[model samples]
Target: MIHFFKQDVSHIALPEKFTYPFHYTPHPLCVLATGEVKEYIAGKKEWQEELATGKMFGVLVVQMPQSTDTGYLAAFSGNLAGKNIHSFFVPPVYDLLQPQGFFKIEEEQISAINQRIDELENSASYLKAKERQKVETAKAQATLNQAKAGLKAAKEARELRRQSSLALSEEEQAGLIRESQYQKAEYKRLEKEWKRQVEELEAEVTRFESEIERMKMERKERSAALQERLFEQFRMLNAKGEVKDLCTIFEETVHKLPPGGAGECALPKLLQYAYFHQLKPLAMAEFWWGDSPKNEVRHHGYYYPSCKGKCEPILQHMLQGLEVDDNPLLDNLHKDTKLEIVFEDEWLLVVNKPAGMLSVPGKADEVDSVYHHLKKLYPNATGPMIVHRLDMATSGLLLVAKTKEVHQHLQEQFEKRSIRKRYVALLDGSLSDIEKTGRISLPLCLNPLDRPRQMVSEEYGKEAITDYQIISVSNGHTRIAFFPLTGRTHQLRMHAAHPKGLGCPIAGDELYGKKAGRLYLHAEYIEFRHPIYGDIICIQKEAEF
Candidate 1:
C-alpha cells in the first residue's frame, strides 16, 4: 500500500542514489517516512505488546505513479500476529499461510507423515518385538553361563581322577581325555542353540527398526523438496524489470541454497512491490521496532542494516540497473593518519593505534593495518612483530614485540592471564540501575550469521568476565573503565549491550549500537612483566574522545 506524506517534504533534497542497505545514513526523506510509519504503529494499540517483543520493519521512499509527489511503502519482516497479510503493508512474495496454497497442503502431508511415524514407533507390535529381543538375549546369556559351569565341574572331576595315587593303565588315561573332549563339544552345541533362539527375536526387532528408519529418510527428502518448491515461488523483480526466484539468486552465490526466512524480510517485500507496481525507489531504511533479541543487541526504534546471510544475494539482483551509494567500509581512511609509538625498547614497544584501522591487514586492497605499519617501521623485526590485537574501531595502546623469543614469552603471559588490561569507554545510556563498580559475567561467542559481530550465548559461549567502575556521568552518557579478566572477542561490547549485563551499548559501536564518527572505546592501559628485563612493565595512554 502506498501512503503519501502528510507534511511538507518538498524542501528536503532527494537522494541521488538508493540507500546501500548494508551500511548507510538514512536520507532526510527516508527519515521522514520512518517517523510516519512509527506513528502508524503506535496508533495500533492492540499490536503494542507483540511489537514490544521485537520485530524488524522497513520503509521504502518511492516516486509515485504519474505524480510529482513522493511517498513510501511499509512492511514487516516474516509474519505478525500469526498472519502474513496485514493492512498498510506490502504482501509477502510467497504466502505459505494461504489455506489453498501448495505449501500448506504439502505441510499438512508432512505433518501427517510425522504423526504416522509416531504411531508406528509407539505401536504394540513394535514394542512387543523390542521386549522379546531383550528377554531372549538375557535367557541366552543365562543358559550359556550354566552350561559353562557344568563343563568346569566335569573338568575338575577328571583332574581329581588323574591325581589319585592308584596305578592305572594307559587305556584309563586315554578314556579320561576322551571324556573331556565330549564335554567341550556338548557346551559348543548348547551355545549355538541359544544363539539361534536369540537371533530370531533380534530379527523381529530389526524389521521394525528398518521400517522406522525408512520413514525417517522419507520425511527428510519430502522436507527438502518442499523447501525448494517454496523458494521457487518467490519470484522477485528489479528496477530493470528482470525477475528471478530465491533459488536462482542464491545458486549464483557461495551458498547454493536460500537460507531460512529468505524472501520474507521487510526490505525484500518493500522492493518487490515497488518494482511490480512501477514505483521509482529513492531510498530505504530498516529499523528494530521492539525489545532486543535474546542473543543479539538491538535497541528499540534503532535503524539496522539488512542481514547479509539472507538478503545479500537477493538484493544483489534486485538492485541491478539502480544506482546505489558506495560502501563506506571499503574506504581507506589511514593514508594521512600517523601511527605513534608511545614506548619502545630493544625487546618490545607500545604503539597508539588510531581508530578505523585494522589491527592486522585484511583481504581489502587498500586498507592499512597496525601490523603492516609496525612492520614498515621495524623492517627486520623477527617473527610476526605484532603480539596482540584490538578491534579495528578501537583506538589506543597496542603491544609489539621486536623479536620472536620476546613475542613467545609475551604470548605466554597473555595465555596465563598475567597481563592486566584496562579500557576507557563511553556508554550511550546512563548507568542509573547499576552500581558505580560491578562485575559483568556474560559469556560471548561469534554470531555466525553476521560475521565479525559477537553475541551473548550462554548455551555455546566461552567465559567472558569484566569488572567495571564508572568514571563519570554526563549528558545521559556514562564514562566507564573496564578491566577485562578474560580475553574474548568483543567481550566488552557484548557485556555492555546484553540485557543480562549493563544493557547499554558502547557509543558509536556499529556492530552493537549506532554508527557514529568513531567508536568511543580505547585501550588505555596495560601491565605485564618484561620478558627479558625481569621487571614490571607498565604503559598507559589517554583516549582522544
Candidate 2:
C-alpha cells in the first residue's frame, strides 16, 4: 500500500486540497531547502557568477524518522556548480563523476582526440596539399583558356577564307578547314589532360580525407568501448541492498535506449538518499527555485513533472520495491461525464466538450474519448468522425461529421480558413487597454525531448495566429476572447503565455502555467457552412468557470 506521512498537529497550515505534487508549489520543507541553497549561493563567489547568468535549481522534499517526531529532509537536485558533480544531495543513479571512472577517462581522451583532429586539419601538410590542388586547378584553367583561344583563332581564319571565296582557291579553303580541325583536336587533347590532372588531384584529396576519418574512427571506437564499460558500472542500490545496473534495468523494462538526462532528476536523488540513509519514504515534491529557461516555461517556484522521456523508464525500474502513490494526473476525472451534444443532424454533429475529456482516444488504455463514444453511438459513422480537436484541458464546442463525404467537406472548409472559431480564456495577469486587443502571431512546435508540450520556436515551428480581445478584468485576472486564424497545436496556450505575445499564461494552464481546478480556455463559439443544407451553421457555448 502507498504511504503518506502525518503532518504534526501543531497549527501548521497545509493545502486543503491535494496539490498534484509533481507539478505544484514547493512543500514547506522544500522551501526551507531553497533558503539554504540561496544562502549557499550567496556565500560562494563562484555560484554568484552562475546565478547572474541564470540557472534552474530544484529541491526535493523527503521524510525521515526522529526520536521526538517525524523529521523532513530536503535534498537539492544536482549541483550548484552546474557541472553536475556529487554533492550533499543523493549521488546520481549513474555516477558519471566517479573518480577514475571510464566515462571520465574516455571523455578526456575524446577531447584530446578531437583537438588532434582539429590540429591535423590545420596542419602544414594538409594546408600544403590543399594549396597544391588549388595551383593545379589554376594551371588546368590556364591550359583550357589557351586551347579555347587557339580554337577561336582557327574559326576566325575559316570564316575569312569562306568570305574570300573569289581571292582564295578551293585547296586553300580546304587547308583552312584542316587547320581548324587540327586546332579543335589540340583543344580536345588539352581538355582531356586537364580532366585527368583534376581527377588525380581529387583522388589525392579523397585519400587524405579517408586517412583522417580512419584515425577519428579509431578514437571513436576507444570512446565507445569506455562508454560500454561506464554503462555497466551504472548500478543502483536500494534500502534492502538489492542492486541493478542501468543497462539491465533499461533492457529488461523499457526495451529502448536510455534518453538524455536519464538519472538526472530530483526523484533519483531523493530516492537514493532515502534508501542509503534508511529513511522511511514519505510524501515527496520537487519545485523550481530560480530563473525560467529562455526556451521553456518554468516559473520560479512552480513544481514540474519529472521529464517523461528521460525519467519514466529509469523511475519505473528504481521504484520497483517502493510503495509509490498512483500519479493523480493520470486519473480520468471526466470518466463518468457524458459528451454534451449541442447540435446533431443527418450529416454532422456538434458537442460541448468537457475540460478533462480527450477529443479522441490516445494510448491503448485511454479509450474514453468523444470520438470513441460517438462511434459507439453511431456505428455507421464513416471516415474520421472528429473533424477538429480541442486540447484535453480545453472545454467547449467541437465539430463531428457523420459521414466521410461530410467530413471531407468540413475539412475543406477548415483548410480554406472558412470555418471560424472563438475561444474564451482567463489570463493569470491583468492587461492594459492597449494590450487588451491585438493579434498574437507566434510559431509553435513540440519540445522534442518532452512530448505533447509545445513551445514558441521561431526557426522550427508552424505559424500560429490568434486575435484576442479582453472581455473583462477583475481581481488581477483578465477574461479574454480569442479568434484563432490558424489551427496549430496549442496555438492559443503558447501565444497567451509567450513573452512576446501576452506574457501571461491562461489561468489554470498546467503545462504552460500553474495548475488550477481547470484550464480556463473554452471554445465558446464556432461557425461553418453546412455540408448538406448549404446553410451556415453557428454554435456557441458558455464556459462553466
Candidate 3:
C-alpha cells in the first residue's frame, strides 16, 4: 500500500501558467505519503482549488504493494471527465486539520496532560492527609502536657497526706490512683498519634516508590537506546555488522558516560562510533555526514578513480574469454579453407591459413575457425596462443605458442616493437614512383555512431604508424609491400586509403576502398627470437597480391 497520509499539499506549489511546457509532472512530496493510487496523475481538481485559494493540503499518489514514488497527485486541474472541476471549488486550509504527523504529536501531548492531571489529584490527597496528621500531633501534645501536670499535683497531695501522719482517707488515695490512670491514658494517645504519623509517612513513601523504580528503569532503557543508536551508526559507516572491538568500546566507554536527559547520550555514541570506524579519527570530535548522508564512503574519505574511462567496459569484455581453455575457431572455420601445419616444436606451432578464413573465431556464435583448428590439430599443446592475427579476408603465415611462458616472450617482443611484420596488399591506385616507401602516422579511434568502423581522430586518439612500398602497377591497381610500426584495429586500411598515401583502398576492403571479391593483403613475413632455440628466426610467405 502507498502511504500518503502524512503528506501536506501546502508545501507543494504549482508553477505559473506557461512556465512549464508539460501540463502535468510528478509532484515532489510523493515520498511522504500513505495511500495507494493506481494510475494517479498530477494536476487534479482538488489541487486547482487549493492553488486558487492559496492553501495547501496533504496529497500524494502512490504505487501499490511497493509504495513507490512514481508520481504525485496535486490540487489543480483544468477539467475532469465531463465537467470543469476547477470552476466551482474553494480550498479550506484552516478548517481541515487532516490526520498528519502533527496530529500524532498533539495526541501524544494530550495523553501526557491527562496523566499529569491524575498525578496532581493523587498528590493533593496525599498532601491533605499529611496536614491532618500535623493537626492531630498538636492536639495530642496538648493533652499529654495537661495529664502530666495533673499527675504532679496528685503526687504532691499524697506526700502531704503522708507527712500529716493522721489516718489517710481512702478516697484521697483513690483520687491519686485515678489521676495516675488519666496520665497513662494521655501517654497512650500521644504514642498512638506518633505511630499514626509514622504509618502515614510510610504510606507516602510507598506512593513514590514506583516513581523511583520508573526513573531507574528509564535510565537503563536510555542507556540501552544510546548503545543501539551508536551501533547503528557504526554499521552505517563500516557497511557491515560487527566492527572489531566495538562491543568492548561500548562496555568500557559508552556505559560510563552520563546520559544528559536520554537524548544527548546518542550524540556521544555516534561520534565515538564514527571515530572507531576510521571515518574520522578519535582526535576529531565533530563531523558532518554531508549533504548526501547515505554516502559513508565519501564521509570516510574513500574514492574510486576511473582507470580506462569509457574504454574500460569494452576492454573488460574482451578479456573475459582470454583465459578460457576452449578455442572455437577450430570447430567453425569456413569449409573452403583448411589448416596446414607448417612447423612444430615442443613449445610452438606454425600453421598456414587459407584465404577467406579467420585467424580466430568471430565474436558471434559458430566457431571451428583457424585457432580452434590448430588446437584440435595438436591436442597435446599446453595452451594454444595466437602470436598474431590474420584478418579473415586476408591470409598467410600464422604463429601459435603452446605454453604461456613462450606466449609472453613473443608478446613482449611485439609490444617493444622488436618483432618485424610485413604484409603485401593490392591497391586500386597506380604508383608513379617504383620501390618508393613512405610512412603514414595518424591517430586512430572507433567511430562513435558506427563503432565497428575505425576513424582518424586528431584528438582523443591513439598514435598509429605504417610504412608502404609500391611493388607493381598494373590493370589500374598497385600492389604494395606494407610494414606497420604499431598494431591497431584497421590500421592498414586507414593507411592505404589516405589521400596522400596510396589513395587506393585494399583490393577487397568494401569498408574502405574499391570492393572486390577478395582482399589481396597477406601476412608476408615475421621475425622474432626463438623460445627454445635461442636463435633469431625469420618466417616468410610469398606475396599474395
TM-score: the better of candidates 1 and 2: 1
Winner by lDDT: 1
Error of 3 at 198 (Å): 79
TM-score of 1: 0.93
Which residue ranges in model 2 land beyond 4 Å of their true spot? 1-49, 52-69, 73-78, 82-88, 94-101, 123-139, 145-185, 192-208, 237-242, 252-255, 364-367
Give the clash count for model 1: 0
Candidate 3 residues 1-545, lDDT tens each? 11234444555542222111011122333323212221232335444433332211223232223332233222211223332222212122111123553433554554565565457446866567566656766766676677667767877876887788677688876876787777678778767877777677657755655564565565566546644544333221221222322333334432433222121121222222322332321110111111211101111111111112222222122223112222222444475456776667788877777776777767753644687676666676665488878767677778799887898888888899998888888886677754487888877887543344566777866989998888778888887888999988878887776554455678766445433667778887888889778788888878644
Q: Rank the candidates by TM-score, best first.
A: 1, 2, 3
TM-score of predicted structure 2: 0.83
Against the hidden reference, what TM-scores do the models get?
0.93, 0.83, 0.39
- Model 1 lDDT vs. the true structure? 0.90
lDDT per residue for candidate 1 within 1-545, as digits (tens), equals 99989899889988999999998888888888899999999899989999999999999999987886889999999998888999889999889999999988999998988998899899999999888889889988988899899989998888788787386679998888888899899889888888888888889888888888998899899999999999999999998999999999999877799988999999999999999898989999998888998989888888889888888889999999899998877788886677899999988999999988888888885788888777778899998888899988899889999999999999999999999999999999998767999999988888866667788887989999999999999999999999999989988988998888899999998777888888999999999999998899899999988
Q: Candidate 3: worst 10 consecutive residues by lDDT?
A: 281-290
- Which is the leading candidate under TM-score? 1
Pairwise TM-score winner, candidates 2 and 3: 2
Query: Residue 332 CA error for candidate 3 (Å)?
Result: 5.8
lDDT of each: 0.90, 0.73, 0.51
State residue 353's C-alpha deviation in candidate 3, in Å: 2.2
